[model samples]
Target: MNEMNETGAHCHGDAAARVAEISGLFVSIRQILAQMIDGIGVPDARTPKTIIAKLSELQSAHLKVLAAEEAFHAQQDAVGGADTIDMETIRADIRGQLDRIRAAQDAGPLSGGAE
Candidate 1:
């Protein structure tokens, strides 16, 4: 039983290390691409600058998504599994925020028209 637990823990650690490695690789790739784009200004007619810009944007967005996913997973694990919060609860929270925003919008100018 003890050996099984140890093996499980080791596998979890390995998974975490792999995630970190992948995250680092994403950052490195983004940086390298940005540097390459910078080094060659005024791309040839065949290679538009917008293409590189789009690739950079894609990488940046991917990193953000991965980071958010990792954060969500960590939070889920910290609070004991993903089922801790039901869909209804999340939807209710969103609804509450929307209600608050709508109320604020309805309130109109808060400065009392003083300028």
Candidate 2:
């Protein structure tokens, strides 16, 4: 039926939109990780504090992404179809980036050396 087809199309479109939004969040987290990595070699006294602040920011963004993904999953479930996105893989990637950021913080200078 034409109505059924239209509904199906709408669901697919919705799934695609959610995927795009999740992908953008992943990109944002990766950018934060890149910034943390770049900060590693800076010799300023406040570099550690700055990195910690950025890590906190990254965690906050990560929580938002997770919440969005959960909502997306719920929507998909309501539509009754297989998931269009591999949420587990995306979560693993995010975790890995977070781990790397934590490692960088651990390896960074501890003393408040002169900037």
Candidate 3:
């Protein structure tokens, strides 16, 4: 059963790694959002444009993470049907990332107005 244990450990380790990577992506997105907010007062469109580009890059990374998470879920479900896994934390993180992105989008483009 040592091989089984090793396999299980590997699976868990992989899952944890995925979670950590996704979490880091979300954190980076949040940081970009904050940077964008700070960009609002820069009085230069170029600054905000750079910030927006960074945000877009973060968004792309987030999408990639979401895709990987979805693939992981699909594989787990295929292996064990509905009893496959508890991916709630990962799902929650994805949702949180989405909400933050939406909020940042809704905040509107950076403005030159005074604080």
Best by lDDT: 2
Residue-level lDDT tens digits of model 2 in 1-115: 5786578678878977876787787678767756664655544666578676766666676677667767866875677644555646876898999999999898988778788
Tell me each candidate's TM-score.
Answer: 0.40, 0.37, 0.37
Q: Assess each prediction's global lDDT (C-alpha) against the native.
A: 0.70, 0.71, 0.68
Point out where model 2 deviates above 4 Å.
42-115
Model 3 lDDT tens row, 68-95: 6678667655776323555566667988
RMSD for each of the candidates:
17.7, 27.3, 26.0
In model 3, which runs have C-alpha deviations exceeding 4 angstroms?
42-115
lDDT of 1 by residue, 45-106 (tens): 78777876776776676677568767856864687633344746776898999999999999
Better of 1 and 3 by TM-score: 1
Model 1 segments more than 4 A misplaced: 43-115
After the best TM-score superposition of candidate 3, give how far the Cα of residue 107 lies from its true spot, in angstroms.
71
- Candidate 3 overall lDDT versus native: 0.68
